[model samples]
Target: MKRKTHSVLRSRSGASITFALLLFLVCAVVGALVLTAGSAAAGRVSNLAQSDQRYYNVTSAAGLLADELSGKKVTIVRTREITTKTVTEYKVNLAGGAAVNANKIAETSSARYTTKLNERPEVPTELADYPTDTNDGAVFTDLTFLDTIAVKLLLDDANFNTDEAMNQSMKNGPEQKGVLRVLHAGSTDADPNVGVADPSSLSVDCLYVVQPDGTIILTLTNSTDKSGETYSLRIKLSPSINETESETTETLSSNRDSYTDSGFHETVTTRTTLTKTAEISWTVSGVEKVVSAADASAQPVETGTPIETDSP
Candidate 1:
């Protein structure tokens, strides 16, 4: 009976040991799976952050280009039709953990430029006054003043040439005497032609004039006709102020009320002066923008956040 009891006890001990080993093995496998899942989640987050950074860079580049093309100043206006190119590059760093493991990145986008040469002059209301004689010495009146206008226009076909036509059209002014003269800023005295002379070449025109009151006016314009092409237009103006001049003189006269004539025919004299000046006035207008050939197919789908930094 004792020997049989010992055998049963030993068999039971062996089963307990086996069960413990099995539990340990299962626990180890579960732990390993949990660690692997956590690593994969971290990797995915890193990838997303990198993607967002790249988007920020691209958008920043686009904004900078827009500012350069559009400003408050009148540029010389490009002489050639613009063709843009995209140059993109990327750089990465691993020091910032999986969240922001990227560093400095740069991209350059450029476009060819052209000028527009067909712009309308702005008109302004002005006051004019002139001195003539003693009675009704001066006259005051209002005048409608015309400002200078110039622009650049892009043509539909690159091969087309319209230089001569443009000059002719711009020179078609009234033949009557006292007609306003339109002098091309830098044209020769023989032919003061204005407007784009060649359709193939981009045209840039600038206009300048002063009103009777000495007020200056300037205008600029831009245009294009390329399909899928984008153009930006900007304008600026500066006017001059008028100045006045004056003079003074001395004179001597006898006192008639005091009866000073008894002492003798005292020397009598008189003094007088005339004043003249101009009044200037001006008005400006004709600011416009247009685009052609937008690519609908090229539009990209939004995959994530459209903005760069959420706050700053």
Candidate 2:
């Protein structure tokens, strides 16, 4: 009976040792898996931080270059590698100015003049006829001015080529006779107002006068008022000349890409590029000066016409 009891005790001791070994093996496997997951998460966070830093460095460098080039008339190319992770590059070009084209200038100027007339209010019928007493020195007596009056000198060319045609057209006045009409405000009809002057009686001297020296003159006179009132009308001309001058600036661009290896079998690539341009314009006012395509940048330059008002 003593031998049997000892055998049972030894068997129970062996079973306990086997169960403890299996439990220890399972815990070791779970610990290794947790360590692997932690390492992967740390690597991902490191890559993200590096990428964000690279992006910021590239953008900041580009902005600095752009600010330095503003309003400067120069052409240059520059490249910089801030670090292994960031690169930046830029190119700038200063385009030179040229005289405005002739045909374009004429078309643009005519269109602008027509547009101005269309936008103005119609003059009253009472003011249409010239005063019988030219000695009084007033175009209209006791006139109710309904709209601001404007006058502009135009270069007329039949084929827009021959000097003779241009001279004849200028001397004879525009192809279409200058007609004054009485228009009601805000009317869109084709014939919104009645013609105030006899077509044959309309004279170039009343609106525009051309000189033998190729200088055109515009005049506005009103002496009939008891107050003897006079006015200065805002005038705009050479629409094409303005647009062509504005387009003198030109823009150019370029791009480049590079790559470098990061640790852990990873690679990082960066791309950088830049574009820059320059601009110039010309302006002229009054009919005394001629703005030909050959001499677009003439003297007595103006940036643009002043805003028009009806008060005068």
Candidate 3:
């Protein structure tokens, strides 16, 4: 009986030993699986961090490119300030007068009747189409006896179309004398020859922004100092020039009561505005490409991918 009990106890001890070994093996396997999964997760997280950094840098570079293109899109704006005021022009004209030969100078040899009087002076283009509004009286009169009456009427018209006359006429005037030689002269509401007047000749600058159709947001702002290569923008601007001329006639009467002669006065008005618009039609420059080879190659070599052979 004692031997049998000893044998049973020995058997139980062996079975316990075997079960302990199996549990040890199972624990080791589980630990290995956990270690492998944790290592892979850590590697994936590290790679993601580097990818994010490289992505930001690349995005920044792309933004710089877009800005470079934007900067090239430049244009000129023109602006003009116009000053204008209405003014009353005063002039006195003497009518129906014949040249009474320089106080007894012979009519046949009068300087006023000289051949030089027949020669007309050449005028600028602005004034070529416009002629004087007033008529100079003829050398001879109907009444033979009255020919000796009008004051020598020495015509001094050299200053008539000069700048001095133009500027002076703008100011106070009784301002002129002798178409008919009335002392106070006469008053005309408007200048008959205003038609040849200079045009507005004004310009203004305006900003044009191309319509934003795609709604592309420039999340990043970038710029370059390099003067971009010259290129033309096929953009168009509405440039135009317009000119106008108008004339009106009114009855003329001497302010002085002594004269009751009926005559017509002419008023000419002209306007011109000047601007050079052909500039836009030519070269509208903008850089083609600004990024240099060095710039592109300078990116971090291992930023997105870690190729370290020693990574555990």
Candidate 4:
């Protein structure tokens, strides 16, 4: 009986050891599964963060490019390239008065990423079609009388064409007779026949003269008109008389520091071209004239052959 009891106790001890060994094996498997799942979650988070950072960088650069090219009438192209564990490229194009287009290309061992961006300028709601004009008279007027009027006749003391006449006319007598005279009163559509007016007949303070070369000369007898009055004459002419055109090209480049964590490196290049054009236009009198800034210099008087006024 004693021997049988001892054998039973030994069997129980072996069974306990087996159970402990099974439990340890089960714990080891659970620990391994937990570790694997944690590692996978961390990797997914890292990839998501990297993707967001890359997108931000690309879009930031593109936004700056758009701002620089806005309201500019030119063509520009910008490019960027990166070669590492993954290959990446970017391109941006801007055309005169057109929208901006951006493209991104990325190649990696696992996947490829491509994106496109289109940005356009917004149309202004309040834009003026025609500039404001200050002149209150007819758009087209004749200035031929100026050529026939004698410079000495204009300076005659007997006439009220002086600065004092302008002031007295403002205060008294027939609205200051002959403050302004219309010579030919021609239109922008067609040229009118030259008509000479008698200097004796012109009582106004201002004279409009037309030159054979299609130049318009304005003479103001009163110095006050220069300081006080604003003329509202619109002349569309070319600037070729005084201005010349030019063109130029420029190149720009940059390099970005590598992102150690993301393993990204990039280099950017940009090329720009600038072109200038001359402004030219035909005058209302159907004559080619140089459009210049207002000059106060006295014009040369017509010489020889006094013109006789047509008999009424």
Q: Tell me the whole-model lDDT of each prediction, alpha carbons only.
A: 0.29, 0.27, 0.26, 0.30
Task: Assess every candidate by TM-score.
Answer: 0.26, 0.21, 0.24, 0.21
- Which 10 residues in a row give candidate 1 its minimum summed lDDT? 125-134
Encode model 4's per-residue lDDT on 60-152: one tens digit a residue: 322332233222221111111111232243332333434433333432211111111112221111112111211121111221222112111
Q: Candidate 1 residues 100-159, lDDT tens each?
A: 222223222222222222231221111121111112111112312221211111111221
Task: Candidate 2: give the clashing pairs.
Answer: 122-183
- Which 10 consecutive positions of candidate 3 have the poorest summed lDDT? 107-116
Global local distance difference test of model 3: 0.26
Model 3 segments more than 4 A misplaced: 1-19, 22-30, 37-61, 64-67, 70-73, 81-217, 220-312
In model 2, the worst 10-residue window by lDDT is 105-114
**lDDT comparison, 2 vs 3, better candidate:** 2
Model 3 per-residue lDDT at 208: 22
Instruction: Give Cα distance to truth, residue 270, candidate 1, Å.
Output: 53
Q: Could you tell me which residue pairs clash in candidate 4? A: 135-232, 142-184, 142-185, 142-186, 178-203, 178-204, 179-204
Please give, for residues 1-312, the per-residue lDDT of candidate 2 as tens digits. Answer: 899988886775567768888999988999999999999999989766544433332233223322332222211111111111212322212243333221111110000001112223322111111222111111222321111111111222222112221122212333222222222233344773664223222111113322332222223222222232222221212211111101121222222333222111112233222111111111213322222423322232244444332221
Task: Give the runs in model 2 whose Cα sits over 4 Å from its true position.
Answer: 1-14, 70-312
Task: Name model 1 segments beyond 4 Å from true.
Answer: 1-14, 71-153, 156-312
| Winner on TM-score (1 vs 3) | 1
For every model in order, what is the number of clashing pairs? Answer: 15, 1, 25, 7
